[model samples]
Target: MAILVAFGTIDGAGLARSEDTSVDALQLHGPLARLLRPLVRLFIRTGMTFPALSQLLRELYINVAEYDFALPDKAQTDSRVSLLTGIHRKEVSRLRGAGAPVNVVPAALSRTSRIIAYWLAAPDYTDTTGAPLPLPRAGEAPSFEALVSTLTKDVRARAVLDEWLDRKLVSLDEEGRIRLEEKAFVPQNGSEQQLYYFGRNLHDHIAAAVENVLGQAPAFFERAVHYDDLSGPLAAKLETRSRDLAMNVLQEANREAHSACETDAGGDWRWIFGIYVYREQMKPADKDIGKDAS
Candidate 1:
């Protein structure tokens, strides 16, 4: 339920390259202090919360070096993760897996093995009789045939990969051929480094959301609803679960920011969504409700 908010290409921040724009600054640095300036009385709005999109980031392939989570303002967490992280729910519903993030071979494949496999398997590829295709490089999406041609050369592996591809762990190019099919999304960079950016992006998002909440909240909220109480290490947890929630956020924020969303809002406001994995879990609570119903 913790959602990582990202302003995709829609915001005009480049998805494939980092831009030194103010939006990128908002993503990399906290701006509540500055945003508060000259705008307190100015009307503002909290943008849409893309909880499903956050989970998609985890389940799908994010070429960290190539793609940045652009949060021009701020991003915030959804409420469910916040709630669920507290009570180790006795009846935790299993969130369906985010499909394999690309079907590329695991990085563990050593150089020599890659060579051997390429030689032995490349020829067997169909146009894929079926050997899997090589994974695409960051930002270099490929067509299905191209992906299949690269990863595999025979049938059996292709079948398994085909299943994964259908499920979205892999995606094809315009030709309806396999392209970005790397299954194992190993952090090509240091794991911590990758997580750090993920968390920062998430961090910026949540901060922005909370900023909106704080700015919109009544001049003085009751203790239970105060901004600080809902954020920080102290808010969102019972005494027993505080540290757990804090640590969970700590480890994940650097890896994925919405880990905080779980705690953002509890009760009816919460939702769990991950398009690449559990997107199917969501549906209209009532057909008559608007998109904002959640």
Candidate 2:
């Protein structure tokens, strides 16, 4: 059986996936193999291997089965855990004592994020039309200083303002009022923020994919368009186009999501919508490598 995957490209570019390859019901393993190649390379770069990561995965699987799954007694036993994770009962017991459990908590919003969130959503800081209000630099009430005060007294408004100014998140007029230049907290030219996002975003994303793979109903939305042969200039243009389009959509979605959460009586969920563009240089073909013999 062949499958037809329609891939719409960025701004008139097309991606054509061949239908020659056999597409079985559970043919997902091929994609998984492709995904794992770079992941395995990443592991090797960080001095890790399949065995250690596999053990960690097994431990996590058991932990989730015990705590998350609805069992008959709502408690996990060695035999039950073994059955769920395909690990021996003795190994399950050993894993329990091997290390501390990894706590999967909601990623806490930073102070900067909180301030930005409020600036974007709070009625006091935003106009009636939901646009961010240009705020007076400092005052007793209804000012940017006041907003920062409501968030944290320990962190002075001057400190926050300086940081934001340095990052170009906000701009100050000659009159000293500050205007929000962006709707989101963007860490300008910094690896720390990017690295933090790398861990947090990928963790939730992989968790969603794993849940769907494990037969959880109403699977999380995970879809992408991948193509192999694009020139660097074309790829760059596509990336710029994607970034603009994604940001426009996400900003509106962010407003709606935050508004709904704020009005809801029971705030029982945490969610993140992450958009990223990745481009990498492909390795030379094996035949070319042999010809070069470097």
Candidate 3:
């Protein structure tokens, strides 16, 4: 006998089978609405209409059904995809020929990120305390030139320096040594690089949540601390403390990963460790609504 669970079924052998369970649409509605609210807000602010988003979602539905839900050793048919996604068979057939969305990291963004990672982690570029050291603009080992050259010799170190200077990612100290800014990892506002990360990070976070919700084993780390009521001063203090702790964790992880990768045989596997903090003022009406629901 198989014991049915909210998400799936556990067989007599004690193995869970997620495919045996049907998804409850009502169970998903509240969560889906919460997830889509901010995204829909972004679309409206960016002038993306409902029709445009609908078309994009239609294509994605077909793509996911065809690729992700396909049976082993079986050709995916339009009818099957249509049934899985609740999209019309004709629409599924039309989109089946369309290319899947490509996930390409911008060249400049990739290069810059790697360079910063190395600077933060490599012993030569960091101090005894593991902080990135200010480097001479040009010279021998430990200089900015050496750091850039270690990553790539195709682009001249001076050219890279100039670009970083223009973007204010790095600044020259009184001694003319180049110092990386604290916010160097952040891309320019409204830039292509920023948008790329916005999509990629959100997608990864949501994917982890979905995997856990689907009762997948070996769940990814997903946890948050929340407080509804706090004085302004208390909230500010907590926010500052949170930022410091988060940065310490990120920097330590970066150092460890950097050392591991030095001798790591490169493979198709990729990993991301991300942290985010958000604070919003609660309106009186919103508080009342919450009280009523509770």
Best by lDDT: 3
Global lDDT of model 3: 0.80
Each candidate's TM vs. the true structure? 0.17, 0.67, 0.88
- lDDT per prediction? 0.34, 0.67, 0.80
Model 1, 1-294: lDDT tens per residue? 122232322221212222332343355343444344323333233332357444544333222211233235653222332232332222112322223332243342332233332322333321242334444322332323343344455534456456555645457566554443333332334444344434454444444444433343322111111111123333434443644554444333322323343366655652221111111122344222222322
Residue 98 deviation, candidate 3, in Å?
3.4
Task: Score candidate 2 by lDDT.
Answer: 0.67
Candidate 3: where are CA atoms >4 Å away?
Answer: 1-22, 97-102, 285-294
Model 3, position 157, has a per-residue lDDT of: 92
**Which is the leading candidate under TM-score?**
3
How displaced is residue 164 in candidate 1, in Å? 19
Candidate 1's TM-score reads 0.17
Minimal lDDT window, size 10, model 1? 220-229
C-alpha root-mean-square deviation, each candidate? 22.8, 7.1, 6.5
RMSD of 3: 6.5
Candidate 1 runs further than 4 Å off: 1-193, 216-294
